[model samples]
Structure formats: C-alpha cells, structure tokens
Target: MALMITDECINCDVCEPECPNSAISQGAEIYEIDPNLCTECVGHYDEPQCQQVCPVDCIPHNPDMKETKEELYQKYMIISAA
Candidate 1:
C-alpha cells in the first residue's frame, strides 16, 4: 500500500528527501504523499525510506489507497522506466 503523512507530521522536512520515488512533498499544511507516485520503496529498498527516517512516526499506510505489493512493484517499474 502507498503511505500517507498524517496531521501529526512536524514538518521537519526529513521525509521528503528520503522518498525514492519523490512522492513526499510539502502540502498546504503538513507534508503529503502522492499515491500515484508512491510505491512504498518497492523498487528501491526493502523498506519505506520515509517511514524509517520520520522522527514523529506520522507516516502510515494510506488505507484509502490500499494496494498489493505486486501492484506497488509494477508502479515502481513504470516510475523507473520513465
């Protein structure tokens, strides 16, 4: 599944650079994750890089955008090829 930044985000600007797919960005309020560009690091790492580096643990799976690992991998492939 893709990940999302919650309101709990501190806006420390740490998670943005950690995203392999560049899915994280500063929203009107806190940081936001783009479900279309998020692949949960499927093609880049064993784990989600943003989750690992977030100091407040505000990032979590986007329940509304649930997706299988295979689907994430496919998205990663498309992202990588582009």
Candidate 2:
C-alpha cells in the first residue's frame, strides 16, 4: 500500500528525505505521496521510512491503492532500476 500524509502533517519536512522511493513531496496544504512511486519501502527497507520518522504520525496506509508485498517490491525495483 502507498503511504498517505494526512491533515495532521506538521509540514516539518521530516518525512521527505527519509523516503527511499521518493514518494513524498511538498504540497500547498500538506505533504503528498505519489501512489505510483510509492512502494511502501518494500524493496528498499523493512518498514516505511516516512512513517517511522513522522513526529505527527500522519503517514497512513492507502487502502485505496493496496498492493501485496511482492507487488510493492516489484514496483520499487522497477522504478529504482533506472
């Protein structure tokens, strides 16, 4: 599943650099996660980096764009390959 930044995001920019997949980005209102680029850190890390570092705990699983662990790994590999 992709990780989403909720309204509780403090915009402290803590989660941006921690994302191995480069899925998090700054937005007008709050930080945003690109589902297409999000692999939930499956291929790169044991757990989601953003969620781990977020002080506000605003990073949440994106149920609307769920993917199995294998699929997430494949997605991450595909994007990071190039």
Candidate 3:
C-alpha cells in the first residue's frame, strides 16, 4: 500500500525530504503523498523513509490505494527507469 499524510500532520517538514520517490509535497494544509508516485520505498529502503522521520506519526498506509509488495516493486522500477 501507498502511504498518506493525515490531517494530524504537524507540518514538521521532515517527511518531505525523506521521500525517495519525491511523492511527498506541501499541500494546501498538510503534506500530501501522491499515490501515483509512491512506492513505499520498496526498491530504495527497508522501510518508508517519511514514516521513519515523521515526528507526529501522521503518515499511515493508504488503504484506499492498496498494492502488494510485488506491485510496489514494479512501481519502484518504473519510477527508477524514469
């Protein structure tokens, strides 16, 4: 699954730079994770970097954008190719 920044985000700004896919960005109110570009750091790290750095723990798996580990790796490969 992709990850999402919830309303609980404190705008701490730590998560943005930690995203290997560059999927996290400053939204109108909070940081938002773009599902299309998110791979949960599958090919880059053992864990989601943003989730690791987020102080408020507002980032969570996006149930609405579920994907298997294989799918996430595919996405990561595609993104890396680009």
lDDT (tens digit, per residue) of candidate 1 on 1-72:
999999999999999999989999899999999999999999899999999999999999999998999999
Candidate 1 regions with alpha-carbon error over 4 angstroms? none
Q: What pairs collide in candidate 1?
A: none
Between prediction 1 and prediction 2, the one with superior lDDT is 1
- RMSD to the true structure for each prediction, in A, is 0.5, 0.8, 0.5
In angstroms, the error of model 3 at 5 is 0.5
TM-score of each candidate?
Answer: 0.97, 0.95, 0.98
Q: Model 2: what TM-score? A: 0.95
Per-residue lDDT tens digits for candidate 2, residues 32-81, read: 99999999888778989898889989898998998999899889889988
Least well predicted 10-residue stretch by lDDT in candidate 1: 17-26
Candidate 3, position 6, lDDT: 90
Positional deviation of residue 75's Cα in model 1 after best superposition, in angstroms? 0.2
User: Each model's C-alpha lDDT?
Assistant: 0.94, 0.89, 0.94
Clashing pairs in 3: none
Name the regions of candidate 3 deviating beyond 4 angstroms.
none
